[model samples]
Target chain A: MKTKALLFASAFVAVAASLPAMAQQTATSPTLDAIKARGFLQCGANGNVAGFGLPNAQGVWAGLDVDVCRAVAAAIFGDATKVRYTALTAQQRFTALQSGEVDLLVRNTTWTLSRDTSLGLEFTGVNFYDGQGFMVKKSLNVKSAKELNGATICVQPGTTTELNLADYFRANNIRFTPVVIEREEENVAAYLAGRCDAYTTDISGLASVRASRTPVPADHVILPEVISKEPLGPSVRHGDARWGDIVRWVHYAMLEAEESGITSANVDSLMTSTNPNTQRVLGVTGGMGAMLGLDNKWAYNIIKQVGNYAESFERNITPLGIERGVNNLWTKGGLMYSPPIR
Target chain B: MANANAAAMDAAGGIGESKLMAWVRANLFSSWANTALTLVVFYVVAKAVFFFGSWGIFNAVWIGTSAECRAAKGVGACWALFPEKWRFILFATYPFDEQWRPALSSAIFIGLYFFSAMRANWNLRLPIAWIAGLGTISVLMWGGVLGLSFVPQERWGGLVLTLILSTFGLALAFPLAILLALGRRSHMPVIKSMCVVYIELIRGVPLISLLFMASVMFPLFLPEGVSIDKLLRAQIAIIMFAGAYLAEVVRGGLQALPKGQYEAADALGLSYWQATMMIVLPQALRLVIPPMVNTFIGLFKDTSLVLIIGLLDILNAAKVAVADPQWRGFGPEAYFGVSLIYFVFCFAMSKYSQRIEVELNRNKHR
Candidate 1:
């Protein structure tokens, strides 16, 4: 046994000698180059959360998050068809992004300080600004989150919601028992099956869950308490700030398109417009895309292919019954102001 | 004396082939085509082994993530992530000062496993010894007294947590399974039906569903103000699930018992319980000891599924550790390392089972 242990240790040491050289492999960002060569973007998404990211009965992936991946694929390649989706759990998301197993995370992940700074990730932009809320059965007669004191709550574990729930309860000095599951959809089912008294997550998620209810959502009520700020967004690794900036601005261009009234329907007409801002955005003006090694009509192609931010939201979120509340344009008394194109 | 006759049959001034070469010639190189195929098989296997050894041993990273790993360089492995997160990967979310409890518990569990596996120690007092030992380990691990602070099972994780789940699961299931298997073959219809219902119901459902039921529906069945930790609930679900399968294994041994043994015991005027306990069960249990060890290896691997219920066993712990921003892209190495640990355990037990099987057959022949 001693002889074997010595042999094993020596073998370990011999293997350990090469690790230092491997560790110095030079921090190069090869993701963009890989995507360019493959002519497609490999995007990771939530597998089966309705309206956020879900696979259809036919096994094709489809959702608002899935659409964001399509939009990125369209922006990179000329066609939105050049996209591959990798399904991921909440616990698996950051690791997937960090490992370069997926080019970017388009899952409905809540942007938080710990995840942003500590996880070596940067939130590109807020695609959906949401808030933590709860949904309970109507028979419970629970009208608000405050009334949920002493109630048993079903929650998805290993997420931003877990921390937010802890913080909310600790702050309010209200105690509630938690029944945790790793998968969100399972927790939703368990909640409805009377195993748990309430289900807690982001407000948009509640609406999506309600919309897909088998017996209709009227049996349940979403309480009016917005417990914590949830900025749902896409994130890329921090290895390449240049690539991060490009992804961030892709989202920024969509918000700017809505602000400047550049609808997908009239994007062609606006491309030929005389307005300095439109000219600058559409290629007749400043060389914005040229700075990033892309063409000046890059933003135009994005808008033409996928529409603006508000359009994406209105087409996806509005139909799921998520009102504009804080997601509306700045002129409509909301907070979606963007940096000017000029 | 037969040399002349053998030389005559050889016909070509030789007895066809030497003894050593004759065996190989017949078995491996019977024809020209067979010789070619054998050489090809040997060459391919050697080449495959050489390639794997070069990739896994020669070029792999063993420690420290450098700029190369950040850029994803090594052709073999990126083990710098394990170096950066060695602690968290070994003990998830556990407080720094109290990690010794889990470490100590793991040592105790390993020692117990070794002791219990020896046939010499397989006595009536061993179960009692196991209960006392495990009880002490749990208290020491979750100490709220004796100047050691309390740590909840939810906070307990990593390799030790996996060990605990498998150990406790076996402790709970094995004896219960034996009794159940016996009851299933009982003369009384009521007890037989009860055992059959239990085994069938548990065997029918998926383990994941049972885990879900434990995590969610279990608390509802209790009166108000009663609560159970999520970890304990998952443990109970695993034990019950294993018990049903183990009951079938024990029943196979019972069925293998000869009818003559039952008749001889009955002819001695012994009661049914006495016949079973004193005469049948011992020989039957000894017959099935080999398969029972295989069940243990299966249980050891199945413990990983507990991660779905939110307990941070080895797989989940390694996941949480690699997800640490400091050790970016460390999934391949950490996952591979943990998988090696699992392979070593299950492989060793399976091999031991094979050895004991041969020994048991040898003894039976004697």
Candidate 2:
């Protein structure tokens, strides 16, 4: 029995050791090439998150993260519909990307240093800037997070949300008990049942829960303070720089289009714009797409098919009642900025 | 009534006592301790029945939108969720207009089971029927040949996918399981050790790990520009996992057979394969029917684990159904419906196993 156990352990270690080496075998854009050969992009997505990634009742995939994949698909195939979605749980998302099962993972995964550097993944660009916040009943009469000194909070375990809750409370020198639950639904139930005084998670999640989970949406108010930086984005395996570049540029193209007053409806007229930047981005005056080994009209395809960043955002996120706060373009005093297409 | 009572009393002299009172006296009020315990249990059960009855049936909203569901929240079950999302829960992302294909396919599966269940159909005809039934189901599901629109395997989900995974997994695993069981007991050391290693290695790991390897790792092992269908990979994993566990159950039955049976076959000068096929296997298989069916029921429910790998089985479909922002917070209604479906399938398997156990054990009972 002991020998058998040893054999299992060693076999596991050997497989684990060989996987990283295998993942590094290809240096060129093999993933992009394979996706082209396959005729459709395989997108790893979140199955249930409302504004980030989800399929509607008719099984149509829609959301901000979903749009990111569509944008990439549009850039490559010139057809945004040529993408197949694979719903991935949070735990399986990174490994699914690393193992080459998915061409791109736009699954509301937070961009963190450890995940980006150590996990052999590259975060292309932030699609949604999320931050941890708290939600409390309006009946509590608490105006701010600092007022809840002795309250018990319900949070999902093993998440940055729980860590942020602890850190934020300790930094304020306040005392609060935590009700750690494993699933989101249970945490929402505990909060609604008055088992805890507050529920803490990402601001978008708090908004989602308040809008949907609560019996009365107006009764729960999300706290004003955000405790952590969660820049959710699209990612690809690290070694495929060309594929990574394509994804990064696709996201940037959306932002740049939004910045350039380009909407999907107006993109055709803008194709004849006299401004050099607009001309270059619209593929009327530059060979930028050739540099990426794609058609000169790659950005044009993305903007035409998947829309600009704001269009995608308003269509997907605004329905969840999330405001375009820090996610707005830099010209509008937000962090969304794009490098020059020229 | 009075005349009849008088006539009965005249015909047979009897004490004036009610049958209900007599039963209560014998059962509930047999002794001091019994009467007290029965009253307590009855009170608790009655209260529970009242609570669930009001919550689930009486006050429940049968048909309405999410607004009505929200209005009845906490006070009653939102049964309206089923009316709204039943199609999504059962057929999942299969094209809405083309849902009748899956519906028909599921009916055919149940029909095939019904046909195969009869004792009279236990022959070559059974296998032939299964082949035809499954072929028709496949044609219906993936229909480009029959003037029906083509629905790819990726769009398949919900109860149909669950039935597909469990039924096909078990059907394919059963023969492989028997082979492994026989190989484990074979005199050839190489074959025996190989079978032992295969079973042990597979049985040692959790099904989730095997599924993870299939979903994530298998693609990496394939050469560049080549990929297998995710559903097929998960199906293979389930088959391998069920095969290992089923092999051990079969081995239990094989070991239980007496040495005298083998000796008797040997004295008859029959070859090993012939004796094993004609004499040993039938009895051994009969002895293991209960445990074998127990494993089948387990594997059937374990198909839900495919949800973790992103395949939408019925349970996952229910979850996705409730995940719609408009219908969020109605998980209990969706899950209750899902549980009923699972219970029906698993319960049928258990009852069928009991029936076969009794049928096969008739001679022993005599």
Candidate 3:
């Protein structure tokens, strides 16, 4: 009886020993399978920040980040309605992606080297070029980031914004007090309440915050200096290179569509034309989509379902009164550039 | 015929039957003062129920994705926001696919808690089971070894963090507290003074400052190259906070044990450890059970403070969900959802403690 029991015990131990290994093997990037099964992309974006991502009073998500979500949905399902948006804070964003809580993240998140190698994420593409800058009330008359040496700055916790602020101040040999708040709304309130002398975040965010103000937009001025190179873009988990390619090209196609003037309003007429660039981009004369495991004319569906890059921006970001400035196209000598469609 | 019936009832002394006025006289209208107080109580209760019903039920937005909750800005609750963003608020960045981790873990946690709360299992065997079960849970959640790809602690968040912090915190605190309590009562001057110093200082300060010290200062205490995980620091702070409170409660129990019980142990020729473990402790622990459970509830709510440390819990998760540009202007729904989750947990704990109190009282006679 004791010998029989020993045999059973050994067998049980062997099975239990391999369970974690089996779990890891099975857990390899379930996100792609899930998205294919659901036929819609689950996206993570910031909940609020005017020019980047924000929901309207009607509960419709808008802004550059929201557009990225829409563009992915349009690419996959040929309709933007298939998207499900999950909101995340800066600290929560990477974890969410690693956990597969979201298929892709386009919440104006900066792509950094440490995040690329250490965080287990693949950067799809940079959609917005932004940099960290400080914003102070015009009443302070602080002309530059270097001038405000001893001012108390309100910063959102759990963001590189805080660390960069610390670095800048130390480098400049300036001493400043920090009043940390988690939510942007709280930071805005505290700043308005005169709890801090300044606020620091992305320059575009400063413009967004300034526009979101109530009574009037007369109170704040964004400093002329830009700090860190914040190439904010979309990201996905590090697996399934096929899925990553699809997301990356969707971004490139948006910029390409804008340069080609193939917008939602004109996509049908353009699709009918024999123009080589349009035919190549719309996949009518080439096999671009098949390379990414998608159908031909995927680019056409994307632009048709969701507007071109410029159309999305004007409808969403332009209302925030942030001129394209550096976000303008390459033909106009700005940074918006996409490689040839062919 | 009526007159005859009235006469018969009067003769019977209202034993089997009574009129409306008679019932009023017997229960509430017995005296003028009693009737007046009864009217006031009825009025207050009716008004409260009426108002709450109108706001919570009659005008509630319980469907259609929170867009229909136009009254979200009103004084009463706007439940529509909760319905719309319930998943984001509850799960945060947890992969929608593996959300079952927190979900299943939540169920396993609650089930084990209920199992321990069972009267039959409230003993040494049960606490041992609890430790084993929680250890398994932690291993399952934070997989790094056994070929499982590790999920970093930085990504650990939402209700998962809250559960781990409170569960481990309570487990760690109870033992340290017991020792501290014993030390506080010891004859040795050095140990007694050390326990006193530890207890007084921790109890004197707010829990927030202690949390800050853990996250910000623990790194400073460690060697320059050795940086501790921020999540572990929060856990340590929780343990320290819970220990101070638990120690005081234990000290009260120790003080309450009758002198004769101590004398009897001494007469039995048992060593100090044996006597305390076998006899004195059993009685003292029974007396402190109810208060300790109350402390457990408090700690559970207090775990929400991890939000300040940048780890998302129920409260913080709700705020983030509402901040989603898609949900816009639905902060109230998020608040209502999170509040309900907290209420369910704290409410169940209180009820369990009450049940335990009653059972313990009944068994004490034996």
Q: Which candidate is the best by DockQ?
A: 2
True contacts kept of 3: 0.04
> Which residue pairs overlap in candidate 2's backbone?
none
Cα deviation at A92, candidate 2, in Å, is 1.9
Candidate 3: regions farther than 4 A off: A1-342, B1-48, B71-78, B122-128, B143-150, B220-225, B363-366
| Per-candidate clashes, comma-separated | 6, 0, 9
**Predicted candidate 1 versus true structure: per-residue lDDT over A1-342, tens digit per residue:** 443343334334534543453355332234556678767787878754555665432234556677678777666664665776655555556655654556789898888888887666788888778999999999999887888789999998888789899899989889999999986546866887799889998898787666553245688888988998988889986645556766777787888889889988999988779889888877678988766545677788788888888887776667566788888888888878778776
Ranking by DockQ: 2, 3, 1
Whichever of 2 and 3 has more lDDT, that candidate is: 2
Each prediction's DockQ against the real complex: 0.02, 0.32, 0.05
Docking class of 1: incorrect
Q: For model 3, state the Cα shift of residue B329 in Å.
A: 3.0
DockQ of 3: 0.05
The number of the candidate with the highest TM-score is 2
Docking class of predicted structure 2? acceptable
Every candidate's fraction of true contacts kept comes to: 0.00, 0.42, 0.04
lDDT per residue as tens, model 2, B214-333: 986676556433568889999999999999999999999999999999999999999999999988999899999999999999999999999988898999999998888888888988
